[model samples]
Target: MRFATWAGGAGVVSDAGLHPLPSGVSVLDLVCSGLPAALEAGSSALAGPPVPLASVRLLAPLTPPTVRDYVAFEEHVEGVRKSIDGVGGVPPEWYRAPTFYFTNPYAVVGPFDDVPVPPGSERFDFELEVALVVGRDGTSLAPGDVDIFGYTIMNDWSARDLQAREMKVGLGPAKGKDSATTLGPWLVTADELEPYRDADGFLALDLRVSVNDTLVGQDLLSNMGWPFEELVAYASRGTWVRAGDVLGSGTCGNGGCLAELWGRGHDVPPLVPGDVVEMTVEGIGTIRNRVVSGVDLPPVQAARPRPRIRRRDV
Candidate 1:
């Protein structure tokens, strides 16, 4: 079943119709509601009459309790690293396990929402990714026991200039990434995606990104080197992975932004105040957003104290 969070409440897309779920129900409620049983019951129950699609506003379909975005594609890793410096190569640890980081869960943007540019951000970019949602909370889950709730398209908006500066300090991609993350069109449950799974358990979906109707990047979901099972398993090693947690399967191969593109000498037009970005996944639908310019940035002329360096014995 395809589930969505709309203006009224949570709902299911079944029999090719949009049916309202229990009143006051939200996607977060479903995530925490014992996924396997909830889904089974929801699917078995009689759904309410179809709601007019146009009348409903689609939100992110989820307000996850926590978000962990992983870099699982070697090509994306190499491209990102290569873009920063002249050379690029995947790190050895990447092959040993899945690598990820925490991002702002409250900063999520839904389909059709307007994404504002961070003031003074000269290099804004888009990343095409696949995101997963956790259904039941579990810790130290075996790979086979990692039950995923659903899937969606994730557009990880980026500020290249700020990211490059911060990452050099060996600390963050924090302020650079925390501003916005676009999710939706709607979520397709894992049961619905069963047919697309390969023998190795990876979904072979066509993921793409477009700007103003022009295609920029495309890749198969099967291109990923690490299975999400490892990601989940690793995430649960020491801490509990609660229900409603969101995980992203980083950018696909050739699914790059203006930074990687520019590094390769493509020199595409940069994002401005009103450009539209669309991300689409085969069964999950698309999330389209417009760039809204930001205002009231701190003045560049503000003075700051200089750092004092410590002397070392020669």
Candidate 2:
């Protein structure tokens, strides 16, 4: 049973495919609220209007009541090392356990949406990641407590220039990453992917990405330095993971983002006003977003302050 939240010409709505989700709500509302029954029952009883995929806009699949993206890939860590400071090895802490931080869930968007190249961003890159949707709720549950509702594809679109600037300040990747995050298309439920999540507690799948029909990156899921179970276990320590929260499994080695495999050089052209980036992960669906040169809307810019960090009470 897969679940999704979407928008239509009329307005935003909930939809589970078999049956429409309750009106005026989102997938986050249903999953976090623990109402899988509504999804189960809807599978066979509704002739709801077919929400045209084209007419509707896709918001981030998980409203995430909260969001956490982890840096679990050692290759990406090494890659980030070289991209930002010309360093070339993973830090000793890279193998300790999965470490992560909250990102702005409000910045998420769905597949096929137009991603604006941020102001002065000359080194925009794409990161192919698989993100999990949390379905269980508990205060610091053990490794056994995670009941993931589903998975989706995420493009941690990045601006190498800004990222390099922020990391030097001791604070994590902030404004550099604020506007480039993208996710969506659909959320494939756990039940629907039992075969991929094997007994060994590893998710094995083929992940790939391409730009303009040229395959720029590809990798197998078995290569992950840390599997999903390890990530969930470490991430849940000393903190509660609730329904609707999201856990992103960072970018895999050989994945799209240039910082992961290619170094910071002009060997490749940067994203301009009209480029389409399509990424696919086995089991999880593909996400395609077009890059558009954003219009300089001064009013909208003035109304919003520059992005900044807000520490949580935890």
Using TM-score as the measure, the top candidate is 1
- Please give the RMSD of candidate 2 to the true structure: 6.6
**Tens digits of per-residue lDDT for model 1, 1-314:** 67777776777766555677777777778777766766865675434577766777888888888888988888788777777656667778778888888999998988889999876788888888888898778899998999788888898888877888778889878878888998887778887887988998889999888898889988888889877777788899988998889999988877556666766667687788889998888978888999988775884664578767688769
RMSD per model, one decimal: 3.6, 6.6
Candidate 2 is scored at a TM of 0.85
How many clashing pairs per prediction, in order? Answer: 0, 0
TM per prediction? 0.91, 0.85
Candidate 1 RMSD to the correct structure = 3.6
Model 1 clashes, total count: 0
Clashing pairs in 1: none
Report the C-alpha lDDT of model 2 over 1-314, residue by residue, as the tens digit: 55555663112223432335556656776576564653553453344655655555666665667778888777778766787778878889878778787777887887778999877677787888888888778666666766777778888877778788778889878767777678777777776667876557678888898888788788776567777656677777787778877888888776457776555352666667788899988876778888998646343233467567788668
lDDT of each: 0.81, 0.72
